[model samples]
Target: MPHDIISGDRHPEALPLAEKVREEERARIARDLHDELGAHLTGIKMALGLLRESLARAQGPEQPLEQARYAEQLIDEAGDAMHGIIDDLCPPIVEFGLAEALQWQSRMFTRQTGIVCRQRCGDGLDELGEFEVITLFRIVREALSNVAKYAHAENALITVERQGDVLTLRIEDDGRGFDLASAARNGSGLGNMRRRAQALQGTLQLDTVQGKGTTITVVAPVAR
Candidate 1:
């Protein structure tokens, strides 16, 4: 067993604390990436734009003008990539809440992977704490990522429902499912999802059949 797993089992209370620390670190890194690298990228794009204008005004070599325009285009792409990375590190749950974030994530997944994805969210989820909201968002994001990378599914669905004080999150896909035993031995994604669920005092359930599909469900109390 991994050392972290052994430690978590021995001191279950430490799991949530560890998760909190990891999230804080991710947020800090995302902020730095945005404030530093993002600013630099923007400045470079502005400089390239100015160069292009100057070259055009002077009627100088067309080659330099073309190069400046190309550089600006590359900078735009880099800016977009940076924003994606920042979103992954620390999503906009604080700004848009979990429901909107999940919807955006599903759309992005479909756009990026060409896999149709949809979200269905129920009521009574507006009162969750920041920790619970972010944790749940990460769990679903990881699940969808797995689907895109390994599930080879054509369609996916994310459902969030609340029944009384209990909240349920489910991700279903219509793709080839693998043997749970083999995946347990070969991948850490499942374990990561389990750990996040544990951090929430929640349960993670995975149901799958070879050549059929897979569904990951998480149930946790909403009263906390």
Candidate 2:
């Protein structure tokens, strides 16, 4: 068994850092909503307007081929918007425990992207404090998103377990990994994960070997 730290006794800095993380992620979510879903909805609205206009012109009950085609397009757009918004909300946080959520996502990702995803999580994580859980989830989520986008991987693995007083989460991929030292010049994905981990006074280790694979590990004090 491990000791537990409650809110009032946690490291004083953790609260401020957690607040920063909440703000940062929330801002990122808002921006994504405005750019992705907002764009899709706008397109859908325009398509509906065209449909209405075509109807006003007595285009018949069957409607014109172009309008039907556009209607289908609008439906697709709406689906995409809904998916984006749901993703922004972090669907995994709700459907399953954090570990199980990641596994489910990995399976879905593999089916959609043709990459093998493996997951293993140990016990005790389910009882972690709320902030610890949130921060850890964000870090892993950001790492995997990067993998899906950048890593040319055929397979990936995510493992979570507790070691002594520390809880660790890792995301590893057999892909064309890049230089860890150069991450400072890369996209904001890794940076976001680092920030999220730091907010919890946690440590993030990003290990990558070009032509091999990349591994990102996060560890935070379970006792804290």
**Structural similarity to truth (TM-score) of each candidate:** 0.82, 0.68
- Model 2 score (lDDT): 0.71
Candidate 2 deviant stretches above 4 angstroms: 1-76, 92-95
lDDT of 2 by residue, 120-214 (tens): 98987777765666567667667777788888999989898987778888899999987655655656677667666666667677777788888
How does candidate 1 fare on TM-score?
0.82
Cα lDDT computed for each candidate against the true fold: 0.85, 0.71
Pairs with backbone N, CA or C atoms under 3 Å apart (clashes), candidate 2 = none
Candidate 2 Cα deviation (angstroms), residue 173: 1.6
| Residues forming the 10-long window of minimal summed lDDT in candidate 2 | 1-10
Model 1 residue 80 CA deviation in Å: 1.6
Stretches of model 1 off by over 4 angstroms after superposition? 1-11, 110-116
